[model samples]
Target: MKILVCISKVPDTTAKIAFKDNNTSYDTNGVQFIINPYDEWYALVRALEIKESQGGSVTVINVGGAENDPTIRKALAIGADDAVRVNTLASDALNTAQNIADYAKKEGFDMVFCGKETIDYNGSQVGGMIAALMDMPYISYASKMNIVESKATIERDIQGGKEVLEVEVPFVLSAAKGMAEARIPNMRGIMAARTKPLNVIEPSNTDYMTEIVGYELPPAKGECRFVDAENPEELIELLRNEAKII
Candidate 1:
């Protein structure tokens, strides 16, 4: 079983987000980048778990320029056997997924794992796109997966309940919470990561279908108002008038 885990570099959760070029682009002046939490905590960890149990290799892939090397290295430190960095800017989800699909198709990986979405974009589209490009089955929001022989059994979230599925090998899955526990890199893993193979490849000729015209932050939150618990009528009046819920 050769598993490919798609990882992404995103701004740290605590980093202050800002825009540049008159709010047309993100400002990365002093931002700290890390592997996207969904990718690291669920997707990558689950891929590692599968490899460990199945006696195979887990390869991590990222789509970005040299600036994302540190984030890819961190995934390697987390226990991937190797890494691949697409030497291009991940302008949009479609382009990134196409590039990954191009590489994976050539390598003929048995399984591909990706997070449900990237924290920055939250476009939950890459895994399905890859599956389409590779002409394979796609399972989204997978919380658990078990492989026996050449068949895979997957569990995923659905409205009001969970759905279980079975598919053959060579499929794409978008991992969500409950997939696996997060793993922190120890000193030995970090040292080994420094010597791991990180292959850089040029992206395919796929262009983005859409582009960001501009960005604006959400409006600032309004001040809070407190209503006495004893004054139920006043609370109802406030809800009907100021809050406009009634």
Candidate 2:
């Protein structure tokens, strides 16, 4: 089995987000970036587990410039056999998916894995777009998957329940939580990652379909108001008038 895991670099969850350039772009200065949690904790780990059990290779791919190499190295330390960095700015989900799909088509990977969404953008569209570009089946929000002799059994989350599916090889999956346990890179893996291959390729000529105009933070939260427990009528009045929920 040849598995391709798509990874992304995102601002650390606790990083203070800010906009720059007249609020048209993110202020990346002094920001610490890491592999997206969903990509690292579930998608990449699940692909590694599949490779370990099935005796195949797991390759990690990222769509970004050289600055993302550190994040790519972390994926390698987590057990990807090799890495591929598409030399381009991840302008939008569609272009990123196109770059990945272009490479995956040439490589002819049996399975592809990606997080359901990126933390920064929260656009759950790349995996499906890749699947469409590759003309393969796509399973989204996959929580569990098992492969046996060219067939794959998958369990995915739905509204208030889950669905079980079966598909042949050569498919794409957007992994969600419960796919696999997170793995921390040990000293040995870190050292081994230093020697792992990190290949860089220029992206094919593709134009971004969308552009960011501006960004604004949400309004500040209002201060809390206290209501006396003995004043039930007052509380009801407050709910009806101030809180407005009735």
Candidate 3:
């Protein structure tokens, strides 16, 4: 079995987000990037576990520039057998999915894994896009997954209950929490990662339809205006006028 795990590089949670170039772009200056937690903690680790159990290979793929190499290497250290870096800086979800789908097609991977969503963008579109591009089955927001006799059993969280579905090989799954545990690369793993093959490939020619035009932080919170708890009319008026809910 050949499992391909798609990893994304995102801003660290602690990094303050800002924009530049007339607010049309993210301010990358002095920004810290990390492996997207969902990808690293659930998707990649689950792929690794599958490989260990089933005797297969796990390869990590990333669509980004040179700066993404560190997080890619960290995934390698956490047990990905190898990695492919598509040399591009395109952050649009559709373009990134295209890049990964193009590579997956050429590689003939049996299974593909990605995070439920990136923390920064939260688009949650790439996995389905990749599956559609590859003409394969797509299962999203999976909290648990198992493969048996070339069929995949996936469990995903829904509004009030979990949904379980089964699909055959050559499918895509976007992993969420409860899929697997996060791993920290130990000294040995880190040293071994240095020797692991890190293949950099030029991205396939594809047009990006989406672009970041501008960004802004949400407005700050206002002071709370407490009302008498026993007054139902006041609450109704507050909801109808101040909160605008009713």
Model 3 global lDDT (CA atoms, 0 to 1): 0.91
Q: How close is candidate 2 to the true structure, as a TM-score?
A: 0.95
The residue pairs in collision within model 2 are none
Candidate 1: worst-modelled 10 consecutive residues by lDDT: 203-212
Off by over 4 Å in 2: 228-237
Better of 1 and 3 by TM-score: 1
Return whichever of 1 and 3 wins on lDDT.
1
lDDT of each: 0.93, 0.94, 0.91
Model 2, residue 169: distance off in Å is 0.9
Tell me how many residue pairs clash in candidate 1: 0
Score candidate 3 by TM-score against the native. 0.90
Q: Write the per-residue lDDT of candidate 3 for residues 1-246, one digit (tens) a residue.
A: 799999999999899888888888888799888889999999999999999998899999999888888889999899999999999975677888899999999989999999999999989999999999999998889999999879888999878899998889999989999999998999999999999999999988568888776798888888888888787689889899988999
lDDT of 1 by residue, 54-95 (tens): 788999999999999989999999999999999998878889
